[model samples]
Target chain A: GAGVSQSPSNKVTEKGKDVELRCDPISGHTALYWYRQSLGQGLEFLIYFQGNSAPDKSGLPSDRFSAERTGGSVSTLTIQRTQQEDSAVYLCASSLEGGAPLHFGNGTRLTVT
Target chain B: DQQVKQNSPSLSVQEGRISILNCDYTNSMFDYFLWYKKYPAEGPTFLISISSIKDKNEDGRFTVFLNKSAKHLSLHIVPSQPGDSAVYFCAATPGGYNTDKLIFGTGTRLQVFP
Candidate 1:
């Protein structure tokens, strides 16, 4: 796709259930990022992948959250035993290279009941 | 600790006027900054950016000014139009890139009235 694309525009799940969000970045973009915005809060970083380097997971809120980017194109963020507090709009973005302006996907709005 | 903050939650401006959005950061290590615009239910769109090497950058109707000493930055949109109404976010990183992650402000909602 010409722009970053995210699947399941909206997801509604019960607490304690597992959920997976997917992202397909712009073709040839080397950097992909995951962020979430809770109600009335700023965008919180979740994970980042650049090329073949190890992803920086420092921004992940808890151990229940994890992500992986396969072949440097598509990425998935998984939330385990989701709690109500884990609910947020999950956003994905990609840039041509490091330090470049990012192109973003519409985002997946995850709701935990 | 919140590293980035947008003190104002909302602002209203008449069409064809100038709209100024402010942001403050506490991380002195940050060298890059960017502005993003978002409409409801959509992802943020990159608007403009400025590196620490320069204090000001302008692109057509948009301009970004940085005050390194005060750790503050402001985005100016000239001749604001109704279509410009949206939530604006300021983000920063140590290297001013997207490698690690960007610290983001809470966001300011700007409404341009006709």
Candidate 2:
């Protein structure tokens, strides 16, 4: 791909429903990251996957938030029993390697109603 | 706590003038800082970056200044143009070979008027 690609650019789900956001990183990129941006707020780290290494999930806000990267290329972020507070933009980014500049996707705007 | 902070929510500047955006961090361990520019409905793109070892880094019309003692960093755009209007984010990563997670500041919206 020319750049990182994220699916479902906008999503409106009811509270308690489950939602999934997908990201397809650039070809051959070795690192992937997920972040959340609330209204008028900064980007909050969620999780990161580097190559075949175990992902760093320290930044996930709660147990309901989880992510998985398969084959180190495509990734999915799942939110279970979503809450109103979860309404925000979910962003995905990738870099050639850790410490490199990230290339980002436009993001999926998740609205929990 | 907000480890990274951009106190000013917005900034306006006239075309041909310099536009300065400020950011402050409380974490002294941060070793790399970066600036990103974003337009509505689009993702942020990397603008410029500076390592803690250096006080300044410049690329074309963009420059980043870091003051380690003060825990402050700023991005300056020379001769601002209307097309430069967008939300600017300041981000920092802790010292290490793995710089995956970046702490970002609340963005500053810069409006360059012609």
Candidate 3:
């Protein structure tokens, strides 16, 4: 891909429902990251996957938030029993390697009604 | 606690003038800082960055200044253009070995007017 790609640019889900956001990182990118931004807030790191290493999940806000990267290429973020407070933009980024400049996707705007 | 802070929520500047956005951090361990610009409905784009070892870094019309003592960093845009209007975020990382996660400030909305 020319750049990082995210699916379901916009999502409106009811509270307690589950939602999934997908990210297809730039081809050959060795590092991938997930972040979320609330209204008028900064980017909040959620998780990171580097090559075949164990993912760093220390930043996940709660147990309901989880992510998986398959074959080190595509990734998915799943939110279970979403809450109203979960309404925000979920962003995904990729870099050539750790400590490199990140390239971001437009993001998935989730509206929990 | 917020490790990074952008006290000013917004800034306005005239085209052809300089636009300065400030950021402060509480973590002294941060070794790398970056600036990002984002427009509505679009993802943030990397602007410029500076390593802790250097106090200043310039690229074309953009410059980043870091003051390690005060835990402060700023991004300056010379001859600001209307197209430069967007939300700017300051990010930092504790760049030792493979420390990739970035801590970001809330952001400052810069409006460059003609």
Candidate 4:
């Protein structure tokens, strides 16, 4: 693909339900990241991956949040028992390597009702 | 507290004027800073970047100024155009080359009126 792509551009789920957001990064990109942006708020770092190394999950807000990058390409971010606070735009980005300029995707706007 | 801060939430400028957006960071470890432009419902696109080694970096109409001592950075768009109206984000990565973790700011919405 020419750039990073995310699926389900918009989502609305009842509170307590689980949601999975998907990301398809640019071909050959080894690094991927997930971030959450609330209404009128800055991006909140969630998780980062570099190759097969242990994902830097330190930024995950809580146990309900988790993400994984399979085969170093496609990635998924899952939120369990979603709450109203979880409603936000989930963004995905890919780069040749971590910390470099990233190519972003049109994020999934998840709204927890 | 915010690690990367864009103090001005919004700025309005006339077309053909200069649009100056500011960002401040507390971490001296940040060696690289980047600017991103975003339109409604779209992802942010990389605009320009500046490494800590240099104080200024310019790409055509966009220029970035970094003040290491003050921990401040500014983006200047000369002769701003109406098409330039969008939210601008400032990002900083602490580690050196090719790393991926970026601390981002709240973003500033720039409105360029024609």
Give the native contact fraction of candidate 2.
0.83
Query: What tens digits encode model 4's per-residue C-alpha lDDT throughout A24-67?
Result: 99998899999889998888889999998899998898999999
Q: Name the best candidate (by DockQ).
A: 4
Model 3 lDDT tens row, A23-79: 999998899999999998999999999999999998999999999999989999999
Per-residue lDDT of A81 in model 3: 100
Give the residue spans of candidate 2 off by over 4 A: B96-98
DockQ (C-alpha) of model 2?
0.76
Tell me, by lDDT, which candidate is best.
3
DockQ class, candidate 1: medium
**Superposition error at B108 for model 4 (Å):** 0.4
lDDT tens readout by residue for model 1, A1-113? 37899999999999999999999999988999999999989999888899999998988999999999999999999999999998899999998776557788999999999
TM-score of 1: 0.97
Ranking by TM-score: 4, 3, 2, 1
| Every model's DockQ | 0.71, 0.76, 0.72, 0.77
lDDT of each residue in B4-106, candidate 3, tens digit only: 9999999999999999999999999999899999999999999998889999999999999999999999999998999999999999999743567888899
Of candidates 3 and 1, the better by lDDT:
3
Q: Cα lDDT for residue A57, model 2? A: 98
Q: Which parts of model 1 are misplaced by more than 4 Å?
A: none
- State the displacement of the C-alpha of residue B75, model 3, in Å, after optimal TM-score superposition: 0.7
